[model samples]
Target: MDAGILFWKAFCENGESELIDLTTIEASMTDSVVATLPVINPSTYTKTISSPVVVIKSEYRRYHHALKASNEAMPINLLYGWGLIGYWGGVMFLGTLWKVGQWFYYLRFNKSKAKDIEKPNQSSQGELALPKSLAMLRHWILLYIVIPATIGTYHQRLFWWSNIPNRLDSLIVFGFWALSIILGFAGYDTFSGNPTVTSLPEQNWEMLSDRTAILSYACLCWLWMFSGRNNIFLWATGFSFQSFNIFHRHIARICTIYAIVHSIGYTVEWIVYYPKYFKSLKENWFIFGIVATIALSIMLGFSSVFLRQRSYEVFLVIHIVLALVVIVALFIHTSYFGTQYNGYLWPTVAIWCFDRFLRLVRLVYCNFSVFSGKAKTTNASVMYSSASDVIRIDLQPTASSLKGRPGQFYYLYQPYTLRGWENHPFTLGAFTNGFEDSSPNTPEIVKKKVTTTTTAQLSDSSDDAVKLKSYRSSSLSNTLTFWIRPYDGWTKRLRNECIKGGGVCYPKILIEGPYGHTQMLHTYDSITMIMGGTGIACAVPYVQDFLGKSKIAISYTSKIKLVWTVRQPEFVEEVCANDLSAAICDQRIEFEFYCSKKNVPTNISTSVHSSDEVTKQIIIQSGRAPVASLIAESGTEAKLSNSRAAVLVCGPAAMADEARAAVHQALKNGCRTLDYFEEAYGW
Candidate 1:
């Protein structure tokens, strides 16, 4: 008998259902197969039993090493996953500390009486020195030096890469990629004498394929974590959705790279070593993995900045569909492993479900009321301004608990339209408390008549009466306003509808959020806002909040300078006449308007009359706004006054970049206690 068959016979004869002692079986099989086999069948088994024994041992050792390699690879894969979690946890911890410090700072200011408040300069030298120096160091190191700076000659690309993140973000991404590469190749053991894999190169390829596949699975968890609009990371860290968005794109790239490598490694290994390559291509696991990899590549291609900028709605649809395909394909691709690896995948589904649940909660809370008995929904009064090419929407939600704050935004849905499921994010321009019933039954003529009568009353009334009227309207209104620049798609459609309805229409609108972190601008002593066009939506709320807090005697901001740049002087007039009427004549606020139109005169002055019967003269300068000089002047004034200043910029890419560069130079030039905030419009 052959040595291999004889060894099996001895193991079976010992006990088929019980565990055989390898030492006893090997001792019996070696003597029986080696000493007795040659005498019984000398023609076939003439060679010594040493050769068959060695072959059996070599096969057993190869199987042992394969199992050991798989066992060792698992914990390393888990460690890579845990490493990602640890990195984000550290970031959130720092953010939590900053949040707690901010809370205490605000608490101290809130408790102090207005009369007892000390001026910035009156604070003791010792108390100010440490904080001021720390502020300078933080701005110099993190904001100016690390965060905004880019790699190499990518200064101009900053404008193009506005959709991407800055230098610090790149460094973090590179670090993650480097770590993954190291883990993918490291700790893999390959032996030349293995029976399963004849060559060292073949074993190496098989191990590489296995490691990359598992690491890719590990990365999928984070990919989904960063893709949500309702990310806990955002809540914990107080970072913007934009910041996590950059993280999402980079992670997707990394995961896709791993998947590609995994697929290629297996392909090469099968073609070179295994003749069953063509047959394996028909297997369910192989087919689904190829589908997943292709789906991911498609998603990456369509999610480019150029493609997104061209048509966001289309990109959004493609992204959603392909995301589902990739998830499902990946789930099926790894299902052959049963539940061993599915732990990483199910969390992605759970996260997505949780995000959707919160979105539904927000939507229901913001748009519907239990007491209204399902009949009432959020309503919006939309009006189009031809002079400014802007749409003004005053949305009145049924739920009063939904409040607005500076830097918060909402996703608006026009449910009556054909594409009612489509929603767009707009900054919450302003919100007030009493309802204005512009129901569909209300006539446009009646609305015009009421507006004319109010204007007449305001013109004839005394300053106190006008102020009282302004105060009453503002205090008693229950509406949230969103200023929409009439771009393409939904905004353009809204404009057309408003125009068709004689410059105004009442549409059924649904609001889904009050998302985004509120800027703590009131903590600063001086605020300089540089707004361009519809960017004023970001500035108006902060101004209103400051004025409102001051009215309650809790405001920390002493002075606010608003520098607005618009293409049309008419747009400036329109906004100042309405949304900004409260701050127009306020003594603490200063306004500068720049009209960047060829037809507009360089030295034109416009008088904006507030409801308080106060006339504020706003000079509109022609040509582009001197953004750098404005920022420099604000920093210089704040430094001279020994006050903490904040520079807020929200505008076109060119203007924002200019402001960023200006702030960087100011910090570099020893402008202490100055902080910069940017509200980018990129989605």
Candidate 2:
């Protein structure tokens, strides 16, 4: 007797029973059957004894064939049921466990410094009341357990909430929620509801389960691109964690859940339709491979964040490895080798790959260009310090001819004289066509010397006339004229170097960047730039550029006003002595210097908070005519209506914010055109 006959015999005896008899059905149906035989069928078979006898139409061989068909089909339904419920429960359980572990670790290890967490601008003295041990425990448990659970619920609710937004955002939210609800319900139903894909005894639900799992997984991938839709949920549930970091963890959780669905769904589907294939994961390498890939990727992404923050090198390697595994698994999971599969997901994935490739190419070009241009250049310049510790650095183009716009800054690296690796960004103070070299090296001299010299060309082609040396001259000269302030770190070192050797030799300067050109000067007809301390360098460049082109109109009357508030009087003296002298000669320019320490010049208005006289004097003083009235005058509105006026602001962020508001107010009063641009140094 065979397994099919025995199973039928036992199943017949146990009608409407929870436990079906396999041995009796197998023995009664099959004769010397190779598949799921009667030999061991009844060892696991049980009966409810609801019916004593049941008639079988197919006798002997045909009945045996039917029993074999049933056994082969059983595996699919069984596996499908187990996979879905098991994996989902496993992830939720593991997440709960991890939280418990974290709480313990934190409380036991870090108790004292729980209150000493660093925050910007706050005094460090305030101590936390919670002991170090308890704080650590609380922090860890809150992060691991409270965070994920909250985020999951929030994610679901936000999906529903997104439907209330503007059409596009709302559509995205609606579509995502609709798909998620469908998949979740369908997935749960696959295990619990009628688990049969087809009525045929040989056909199983494995193919159906696989299709469902793949669709759900694809949906998860799509959600990655929708940031705004997810933000609501992320904020609500993800409050404990930073927003930017939620996606990876979220995806891992979802993937773990669905992977279980796929595993159990297929397993149960297989068991019901094809019982021989039950617990035959090793035989089905394709299914097992995807499961393995998912498990590994989840572990890698999780470990890299929490356990391996200090092991950056290891984490990076692991991350790359996990990405590769994910790609491979995605490929195999979707492949159709005579299976129920589709290829729509690949093209979307390819786009992401191509985008990353292009970004890499751009980064490489930027890095290579910088690396190739890394050559040391030397120059000598006199540094004259004012009473305010502001240094006036004068240099010829031969030394450093890197010209930049006013307000634009360059990272200066001085290698030979001081520490060059620590680069500092400073705005360009002045511009010159070609500086008068103390030791002249003219273009004619350079041309004559080039015949005997051999150097690489800056341009790649041989026909290109731009040699590396000439390119250096232009690029370097255009990059050099920066005005720096002495601060901590490299600034102090540079000042010390300058003081020690009137000017040091073989100074290797590497200009890193040409950042901060927020002001669009071409857009405005009249622009008033306000500066404090060394910020004057930022305001002066565009003023000089526009004025140099003789774009000034007498009948039109364009006023280029500068209000420079310096702590010391020498700053005004130096500017009057050098850079501003030529510009001041022009009637279109108005410069006001507010010297805070001493009494302001009589020519300028003075409002003093003093004990003596309550008289406010508006001075029109003359040592160097301080244009105090011109500074305070209503030229801004008059000029804006007559022409276009833009307030191009560059200073501290706080100052920029205040100045920006003032500019807006001025525009509101009557300024025809007004634009405010802020350049952030730090944040």
Which number leads on lDDT?
1
lDDT, candidate 2, 39-117, per-residue tens: 3222233754453233233334444544544454435434443443344334335445655554553453233223322
Residue pairs with colliding backbones in model 1 are 433-477, 433-478, 434-476, 434-477, 434-478
Q: What's model 1's lDDT at 32?
A: 50
User: What is the C-alpha local distance difference test score of candidate 2?
Assistant: 0.42
- Top-TM-score structure, candidate number: 1
The Cα local distance difference test for each model comes to 0.71, 0.42
| lDDT (Cα, tens digit) per residue for candidate 1, span 148-205 | 6564323323544454355666666677777777777777777766534458888788
TM-score of 2: 0.40
